[model samples]
Target: MKKLMISVVAAALVLTMAGCGSKDSGGTKVKFATDAAYAPMEYMDKDKVAGFDIDFLAEVMKEAGLAYSVTNTGWDTMLTSVQQGKEYQAGISSVSITDERKQTYDYTAPYFESTNMILVKEGSPIKSALDLKDKKVAVQISTTADTLMTKIMGGDNKSLKRMDNNTLALMELESNGVDAVVADIAIIREYVKNNPNKKFVSIADAKNFESEYYGILLPKGSDLKAKLDPAIKKVIENGKYATVYKKWFGQEPDTKKLLDQK
Candidate 1:
């Protein structure tokens, strides 16, 4: 009888562990990879991650009845992780859903929109990407801005240097080591906020290549979209998304207008 009771207890423990680790029939635990260093979009505040993207995901997951977690694996790695399906189920690093990315991974409807801009030190001569010619410019490795820089400078501009993080690129601009840095406008705002003494300037919207925004990345042929699609639709309808948006971005997001046209 003693041996039988021990056997039953062991089975019960194994079942419990499996239950804890497995996703429910209608729910899934999404591992979201992002660059935790980008502020206002995604960043670490003390021990917790808090930013526009983080807060937006938390709300969307709750509405979808999905379990998810965010892992900081840098921007470049975040892209490859979802592609390889090594550690994450999706990515939320303000990744612009381009045709190239869509060829491999599915993207959800866009949750935000932005345009790239040039950030120069206060009172610098650098005014635009053209002005960056023959000048030292820092760009985050593998970002849209970095790609655009390559296109403008023949993909081998001697002055264009890649950095691991956008913040570091901005720092180079602050220290006067680089003439300018290229990144999204929203990210530039956050950088300037953190650097009080450094005044960053952006030229009026110049006609250049721009990137559209989208969320949701799944491994090729993954079935997670059924769950994410409904949650995104419901969140937009019930206004929970807007509430969360206001909390992070200080204004309501216009997701409905953009997604409606789709």
Candidate 2:
């Protein structure tokens, strides 16, 4: 009887260990982080997260057979949060892929192409980049737009107004707190489209503004990149990418034009 009881206890222990292992390996659940203040890319629609990147990533995750959840983190901390793995595994907030950032994070292939644009109140007389000289330009802090503005207008230029997010920067422009806002062209266009009463106009200078490519960001050497990269390519090849692009931008993606730009 003693031997039988010992054998039963051993079997129970094996079962418990197996159950724990199964739970850990049962499914792929990636925690995704984003700053939802940038519309048409990733933004809060009502109480839920919805936008181009959200929809596009949902398809990519499905293709990769991974379950995922998104958390709205502050833009300043979003990248670091993914890098630290304290709260998220990946970030996708129209994050531009740049050599400087590559050292800190692994990124999926370029998912979207973007360019900088100058936004001004309608009939404000700021028709082009030259008009921005000595103007108070508002930009989201730490974004590529801010970097561009600092480079163009000088870092210590008192005309530069840094805001926490693009929406706030636009508000500053509407209230005449700033003469203009410099930001991603798609973001500016989306904002103007959604707020018909706001009276905003955008100016693009292809010669002056370099096009940027956005990608999904993960911690350095993250295995999620292996799964996500292939899925991104598959979506582009299968028309799903264009479908999502059209849903958000109101026109089908010119795949050849976008891919060739890189």
**218, model 1: CA deviation in Å?**
1.1
Q: How much does candidate 2 score in TM-score?
A: 0.85
Per-candidate TM equals 0.80, 0.85
Which stretches of candidate 1 lie above 4 Å from their native place?
A: 1-28, 204-206, 260-262
Worst lDDT 10-window in candidate 2: 1-10
**Which digits, one per residue and each the tens of the lDDT, describe model 2 over residues 1-262?**
0000001111111000001111232475677877676777877777677789888888887788777777776465566677787667888888888877877788888889888899888888777776787899998877777777778889999899987677798899888999999888888888888888977788998877888888888898888888888888888889999999999898877677655543
Name the top TM-score candidate. Answer: 2
User: Where does model 2 exceed 4 Å of error?
Assistant: 1-26, 260-262
lDDT of 2 at 172: 92
Clashing pairs in 1: none
Model 2, residue 59: what's the lDDT?
Answer: 84
